[model samples]
Target: MARPPRFDTDQLLDAAVRLAAEGGPAAVTMAAVAQAVGAPSGSVYHRFSGRTTLLAEVWLRTVERFQEGYFAALTDASPPSGGAGGPGPDPARAAARAAARHVVVWSRAHRDEATLLLYGAQDFGRAEWSEEHIRRADSGNARVFASIGGLAADLGAADERGRDRVVLALIDLPLSLVRRHLRAGEPLPPHAEDLAEECTAALLR
Candidate 1:
């Protein structure tokens, strides 16, 4: 039987995430990641082809993790029962609130990964990414757009402006709330999720 190596891909990626979160993309060099994880620099290179690939992996991993839950939240059409026997909460609106609240809740839960999201793929060296990496990033983006577009239609706002509003309520607004606090190196407040849900409900109405 073959023995496992000391540093695995996810371990290195985790170190890269912390480095990127603390000092931005420029800080996530192979040497820095290796040093952060107390692994040989060769171990970092063993998993990723170069700094560009490392950056790409870290960015994609963080984004994909965030989006997995976000996509689900946006697509949830089931509404909560209102009181004991009243009609349930509006399914579309409930989904919108859930999706919006998910942003803050996720950020609060994954602060380091959330910080990675504040910067665009371009900031993470996307221009140098492989075609495969580009496709992965594009695919995630297309899914998000489709989910939001679908939700907008369900909420009776299928027009372009209405879709834009959905985008704002679901993506831009909640992210803005997270960005402000993360950039300041402050923790998200206790009411962040409630505030996100409330603001989203107001916009979707």
Candidate 2:
């Protein structure tokens, strides 16, 4: 077999992510990523069609990675049955708490990726993304929104406002906390997870 090429897609994307974290989306040009990875511009161009595609790929990759864990925390568990003794803690509440905590925990763990999230897809050139990239972004969003809706129904949310409350508790609230610290250029405090969890539990209640 032929020897493997020195740089791969992920390596370039990781470099792009770091560049984005340092500056912003505008900083992630093909040459910039190639330079960051010590790869030739040809290596970057070989994987990405152009800057638009590269931006789309990096944005989608970060989002998909985040949603993989987030969706699991939001909807992957059945309510715990009270151990042959009595009623246990509410699973809906537990999931809500977990989802909220995950925002801070994940951001702390993936600071660079989290930085990408701080900006909207538009900031990453969504308008120029290919159809496939757009679909991937939309699909991930739809799935998460559907899961949030299901959680809201479980919590007895009978109207749009109620669902909005779930959205606030599950998404907006946790993200707010993370945004505050991240924008300040500070690491999330140890209590960040607890605060997110407690705030979510309170909203759900």
Candidate 2 RMSD to the correct structure: 3.3
Model 1 stretches with alpha carbons more than 4 Å out? 80-88
Candidate 1: give the clashing pairs: none
- For each candidate, the alpha-carbon lDDT, in order, equals 0.88, 0.88
Compose the digit string of candidate 1's lDDT tens values, residues 88-196.
4688887888888889989999999999889999999999999999999999999988988888888888578988898899999999999999999999999888787
For model 1, the local distance difference test gives 0.88
lDDT tens per residue, model 2, 36-117: 9898999999999999999999999999999998999889555323222122267787777778878888999999999889
Candidate 1 backbone clash number: 0
TM-score of each candidate structure, all chains considered together: 0.94, 0.94
State which candidate has the highest lDDT: 1
In model 2, which residue pairs have backbone atoms overlapping below 3 Å?
A: none
